[model samples]
Target: METQKINVAAILVVALTGIIVTVLAASLLMAYQRVPNYGYVKSVGVGVYWDQACTENVTSIDWGILEPGSNRTQVIWIKNTGNTQVVLNMTTGNWTTPEAENYISLTWNREGQILNANQSISATLTLSVSTTITETDIVEFSFDMIITGTEQES
Candidate 1:
């Protein structure tokens, strides 16, 4: 009976220590700061809209406050306004600061997706900033997100 009591005490001590270590690790992980950035949005061959109706154009993307090594996603609609089927292509250019282009990247869920004429598709746009961006030279930047669509010839 006494041996069992000692074993129980040892297990309880180990569990309590483990819980304390876990709580401390979580607290440390949550003690980081967030960085902020912003950029402009534009479209070319296709319409980037906030609504499926394609009336509310997505003029800009506010990444808001961000953390290093973190990614932000925005959902928008792309409309094929041309008369023929088109494959959507997205590109970024005209960055306000050259360093911004090197540290920040833009991507979409759909790559080389074909859209029928007058059809709209919801797309998730992701903006990622490198965790190695230690340089404080850039707090904000602007860029043109040209979402061009290539016409598929029959």
Candidate 2:
């Protein structure tokens, strides 16, 4: 009879220990669930309206003799027609076809000094065209200009 009673006591102790462990585990899970959640927003902003304008003009090219090895200095006139100041970027190209519309190839782009608002700038466009260019050889040019708020376009 005493042995049976001790066995019952041992079983009760084990059951009580298991219940306590289960309760502790449940409590820890509840605590973990109470943590706050943090997330990031994926929306971004973009430019809506940019209203700056610029223009460039090529004034003159000093002509040279038609030979195999001749270089000439071309004078260009640049103007900023926009209300704001502008920075002019110049690109050199070769004429490939008629109508002066088609360009065969392009060279590295170059930038001129800054100009102020409503201002005009001039630079010498120096190029070493082969003397094969006669008195009426057409040179292709493309103009690109950028305007900054802090810069002047004159």
Give the clashing residue pairs of candidate 1, or none.
none
> Which lDDT tens digits does candidate 2 get at residues 29-56?
7844467889854321111122222233
Best prediction by TM-score: 1
> What are the clash counts of all predictions, listed in order?
0, 11
Score each candidate by Cα lDDT.
Answer: 0.86, 0.45
| TM-score, every prediction | 0.68, 0.34
Residue 34 error, candidate 2, Å: 50
Query: Any idea what lDDT model 2 has?
Result: 0.45
- Weakest 10 consecutive residues of candidate 1 by summed lDDT: 39-48
Please give, for residues 69-93, the per-residue lDDT of candidate 1 as tens digits.
8899999999987677888889999
